[model samples]
Target: MPRPPYLGWLAATLVGLFAFVIRMLRLGEPGEIYFDETYYAKDAFGLRTYGVEHETVENADALLAQGNHDIWTGTGDFVVHPPMGKWMIALGDYLWGLLPFGAAMSPTGWRVAAAVVGALSVVLLVRLALRMTRSVLLAASAGLVLALDGLHFTMSRIAMVDIFLMFWVLAGFTCLVVDRDRMRERIADLTAAGQHAAGWLGFRGWRLAAGLCFGMACATKWSALFYLAAFGLLTVAWDYGARRSAGQRGVPGRWLLFDAIPAFFATVGVAFVVYLASWIGWFTSPIGWGRHWAAENVTGIWARLPEPVLAVVNPLRSLVHYHAEMMNFHTGLSSSHDYASRPWEWIIMRTPVAFFYNGDETTCGAANCSRAILAIGSPAVWWLSIAACLVMIGWWVTYRDWRAGAVLLGVAAGWLPWFTYPERTMFVFYALPMLPFLALAIVLALGLLMGRDADDPQYSPRRRIVGGVGYGVVMLLIVANFLFFYPVLSAQIIPYEQWADRMWFDTWIYGSSGSG
Candidate 1:
């Protein structure tokens, strides 16, 4: 098929924007905090009031809604994650009044940021897929799949950190891809001009941008550290491959000496700096917990340092201690919950958590009522993506495709690390960062099924008809599945019978639909 120049990108953006609008619509309704928002939203409010998270009164949610901002008791709250994600949530509160519309901290405003980021993510995935596959159809298909996926859609509509983590990590990955292409072109141009021998490429601005993105990702969640590490290795490998492709000998050692070490410092080191920078507010505030640690313990190394340097170093030391406490909480968390799930079940979405559920016989217009916001993955998107990943593995091993390698790197970076903490409490929502790569895998698998244009003439007429029909049927089924489950995913009021029917299995009804 002939590609439409930039129309594909424009179309993808429109689709993504539409998806975003749907997520943003009625975002503030169901005024009570949904599920984990109870923790994050309140924490964000605390962070804003005090430099550190403050303890809340019993039944604080109700109290805060009644124009009571003094929920904090001045004691530090023990939170598991870093402050950056909550800071983002606080941005909405900052803009839309400490309590907007007088209906409990505008959920719409808080979630709108996530919705926008999710929409931008769709656009980025589309462009990245297009560059990787050189197929506009595949790129658009990938974006459409993500735009429609229930997991992505629900996360976008909620005030959560995972969405931010997904956005920045994908942004960093996209920047790296752009950097790769630009480096290749520059090397080719220099070689053609015969200006210099192959060695170091000077000051990569794109890579620096990627470093900033990776830093933002880390600030959102420490899980982003895995991606940063994987991407660092992947960049070096790309450099080594580029050198070898250009006929340079000893490319591995050369990459290690000239590219790998410098990239390690530039990417990881820069990321560390940016991550620390995000804590500037807490550092500067005198009331922040542990802010006076240096003053309290003046005989240590921090005391020996100049007062100016101590001002900088002390905050970092406090932050490190805070992180250690957070890490311990994460490691020790083993409390049993009805919705807790194993990583193995995440791939199939066996048990999805219901973030919100409220319905009455009067409101639902049925014997039993059901209104819910389920964090479920679209079966067609995820299940087919699983098959697509198998195809990717085959392509990587049999044909040694670099694109497949890159896609797998994304999957592994976001996924494989979870298995290490099988005993630690984790959620299916953590899979959000890897969903973009799964969408790409699905597109690539479709490309394989569609076959190349050059081979069109060789196929028998019957085979072509069968293949086209099969593809059409699959697409139709996927659309039907999404439509059937839309009410539950969107928190629409429905009869209990209808909701049960849509559940498709007992696990979904039992809050075990691990689809987040």
Candidate 2:
């Protein structure tokens, strides 16, 4: 089928916007902080009030609602992860005010930012897929699958850092892909003009933009560092491949000189500057903890530096100390929670976290009461994606297809690192970064099922029929699964029996008859 110009972009945007509306509808129903929001929401409020996050009083939610915005004084609170994510949460609080029973602390206000980012991610994925496959249907299919995925939907509706992390990383990936295509076209033009060498590719504005996006990802969560490293290598590899494709024999040395070396500054150096810049609030405010640490220490190496240098060094040192404490917290988080999951079980949605659950038959006006929001993966998409990943492995190793390589790189960058800390408590929601890649893999697998023109002509009709049937069945199953669980996911009141049926495992129950 011939691709329809602009139609795919319009379709993807509509699908993504529809997904956003679904996530945003009646989002404030929960009327209370769910799960980790208790920690994050308060931290956000504290950060806004104190410049640095500070401890809150017991039952701080009630206190904050009572107009006691002074819950956080001048001290810095010990928190895991960086301040940028909390700063985003603070942005919501600033715009909506700190009303506990009002919309400020409501699910809608806290999560609206994440939901918007998640929707934009779908649009970005569609564009990226279209570029990779040169097929509009394949691109729309990838976006459709993600928009329908339960995990993506759930994550988008929560006020969490992971969604933002996924957004920025994926944005960076898209920028890098654009850089590759632009570089390839430029090299082709130079070759056609009989220029043996095209040095430096002048300015690389796209790559620098990617670096800024990647830095934002890191600011949201430390896990984004893995993507930063992987993409750095991947971009350099793209340059080498482009040179070789243009008939340049000495590709490696030339790539090292022209691409890799400059990329280090473009990617890593730019990211460092952006990451530090995200802390402007804390760095500039004298009220923040350790803001005066360097000024007070005027007898050491830091003191020997010029005043201008010390100004920069002081903030860096303070940030380093804060990170050390945060790292310690993450490493030491071993106290068992019923919903805490290991990395191995994340793909299967084992031990999904319950964001909210309330059971009162009288209140619900049901024979058996049920209201919940559980972070569970869409079984059809995730299960098929696993098979698709195996296929990708074969395709990359055998055919050396760049598209397959891209999918694998994206999946590995977001996922493999978690396995290194298997003993550490993690959750299925952490898989957000990998979901786009998984959806892309599924699209590629569907493309394979559609069959190439070079394949046997006699079997082409049968293959297309079978592929369409299979694709239809999977899409129906995924939509049905999402609908079946939608009540619990959206915290709609339902019969207790209905909620129990959705709990597929004993581990999903948290001992208080709650569905998590």
Candidate 3:
């Protein structure tokens, strides 16, 4: 293998460090549970203290503020989501004495895990870009753009599961990208040696790693299943491409048996096992919601099973039932929420969620002061990314550029499924998992702007300068856009009119609606 890119890590580390500091700054200032943190934060506390979610008192948030963390009623709460994310949040609460909710309550502690993961995601994106493009500048640029994206920035600072879900999805994709290169190299070596059959590529480390990451993603949120399916198919396609490139006859047939089938086990099968295991807490806890489901239905063949087999089958069966109910809830959820948004508008961030907001007399030292957390995307980044996606569609169709296909696949995984649930109340934050791919698309587009070394022979220096200028302008606009909205994203108190100025349209509102 060639010498590793030593400078790549250094650049990624610096960008990641910058991201970390930005996310960590004033993280605890809000000091109040916001948006879904109300559910996740309390659920974390429950799991930490009682091994499962326990029902909280009606006024639990108010009580927690008054130093009463003993707000649970000791009854099992039927939480809709899985437990791994809660376990992660619980880790922070466990270390900070907040699980016990003693006199000292640290909101920053609740958000520590998110800050760390969010920073690591930037490093991961940098590595992915470096591997895909083999250009240190373009890779670092991807990391910088991701770091500057307002939605990525805002979500990173808050204690939410979506960022963790994004982390795992990106990690899985990174592993798959590595596996793609590895397989290509192995196939090329075989073809050069006059070997037509590249049989049983020995234990693939990256593919297995991707499986594990996808599992963790599912453990975070069920929506990750869409990604699992999308990436699984992409992996198979890569295998077919590798075989065809190697001059193998009947590439599709050979790849189906030799690659796709094994890949199914490597990714989907492993993910399923990991997902089932994530429910261990629910399985073991006596009062866990739906734990008694199988026992309650002892009427049919379930009654004839031997006690030991019954013991295992019961919980598994019950888990399946719970999933059915959860799916039902998700599909039928049409309740209108003030901050809810449509999937089509998500690309342009037409309706961003308001995670938190407060208006007070003294905070701004003016007639009105507003401190808020709006989950808005950088307008420049989002607008350009939409164009980049369209460009990728053409690139994929005309050139069969694997990079374009990979990115568009990711966007589909994170986005297209939501279109099916159009009637469901969705928030812009649900689109968090797509940001990395959008950044990647922009990177690919940037590569076009700054022509590759191969293209240097064909291009005039004047054209190169124009491309460079265009790239710089977009980056500057992205940074400037992020800075302009940083106040609202970070909950910084500002004069009401100044806050209003940041709202580019009437849709950007405060409180229940989108007006700023």
Candidate 4:
């Protein structure tokens, strides 16, 4: 019941500042395109130049590098991902005038938006941790863990959608966390005033904002739909639980009718509308794939509908068809790649994807030097998180800790879905979205070790010493691991021996080989 320290804000701010500086430094280095940056960075430039993605030459990267930015073919590109993420990437291009056709192009300019979002995600995670546990030290610990994570750091420095998606995902989760606390307070006040059946928790602004964040997430990638669904149900459950705790009679039925139904509208329905809105550019463009599918298939039953109605309905139907094709592309993506990894291998940091690698001896300063951007996570942090998650599962099951359950819910939403498509070529970098929750799980476990705050009389002095020493050791290990892997994560040139030293597993040989 003690007041949380105001220093938490100052501490979290310092963490954010450090994260921003590290993420922004030399962000455009390795100047050449790397990994999926080929897709996203170009798509972003194309969007800025043409208002939609357009097909480019086979050597587009080479051409664009020379500042010959007029690379697009003017036709809409059949990209599987949504436009919102590319739009987010284009934001930096817009501000910096780095469009494909601009007189000069800067890769760093395109990547600045991602770096900004990634740094902000750290700040948000710190605040979320603080909100969840009311512990400033623990919150700063969470932020530090995330900032030191190689996967989050790698994704943040690139012109990628995953980082933007993570920002929105964290934002949505933060809103829900705030909503849960506010609802609990409202319930407690209502019960004290003998208003057991307070008809509705009028105008749940936080929940609505959560819905908006979910919508933005989906607009970045369809994968976010899973989070939207999981969180929607989770929020409804929180509402029902709050009402029951308030001594309301017929809690389940009342919640089902009033709270559940409205939550669907507030969260899922709003998200649906927002997802549709993201396709405005696609709908307006005749060149978008499947834009004419409805027109071509409008015979049989469609003939009966009015022309105006068909005009509205057909585009949506075409959009659905486009989604089906995109789904087929995703589900059937089993093409082999040097870096392709299975879902099961992701948690253990196996088979990390190499984003860039240069092994030239002259440029790198050794007989066998390597400059790499490998998307491997911190071993201590990631492996420790795996243990924390397992422990969290047991704690959640035994005592039903809401915090543990929430963290696990996010992990399941981001992770388990990949298991269903194991054959689909996935990589460890895709695990970026779940990193914050994993960090939270680790923090929650550490909190358990730390026992209660010393301000609480129940706290034991001997136990505090043991827990504090253990926590300090773990934090030091994580920092050391991050520093050890910093070179590989940031594409810093190092001797082959040193690079191989960091490759703790045979799967990590990709980091040394420059093949992946």
Which candidate do you rate higher for lDDT, 1 or 4? Answer: 4
User: What lDDT score is found at residue 32 in candidate 4?
Assistant: 71
TM-scores across all candidates? Answer: 0.91, 0.91, 0.95, 0.95
Instruction: After superposing candidate 1 on the true structure, give the runs of residues whose Cα lies further than 4 Å from its correct spot.
Output: 1-5, 67-70, 96-104, 194-196, 297-310, 359-361, 454-471, 512-516
What residue pairs clash in candidate 2, if any at all? 368-496
TM-score of 1: 0.91
Q: Give the TM-score of candidate 4.
A: 0.95
Which of the two, 2 or 4, has more TM-score? 4
Error of 4 at 176 (Å): 0.6
Which digits, one per residue and each the tens of the lDDT, describe model 1 over residues 1-516?
Answer: 226666766867776787777777777766667888888888787777786666788888787667576777856676777778878877766776645453335666566667778888898888888888777767877787888888998888887889889989999999899889888787777667774456777778878888999998998899999999999889878887777777666667767877899888778988998998877767766666566665667675666789898776767777777787778888888877667777787888887777888766357777889889889889998888788899999999999888888888898899999888877766778888999999888888776676654456665656546656766766666677778888888888889889878888677766554333
Name the weakest run of 10 consecutive residues (lDDT summed) in model 3: 97-106
- lDDT for 365 in candidate 4 is 65
Clashing pairs in 4: 69-100
1-516: candidate 2 lDDT, tens digit per residue: 225667777867887888888887877667667778777777777677767767667777776557455666546666677778778777865665554544564456677677777888889898888888777778888888888888888878777778788888999999999998899889989899987566667678899999999999888898999999999999999998888888876777788999999998999988988898877877766666566765776676766789898877777787777777679878877766667787767777666777788886456666779888888888888888889999999999999998899989999888889888866877788888989999999999888887654345555877888888877777788789888888888888888988989887776767222454
Instruction: Give lDDT for model 2.
Output: 0.80
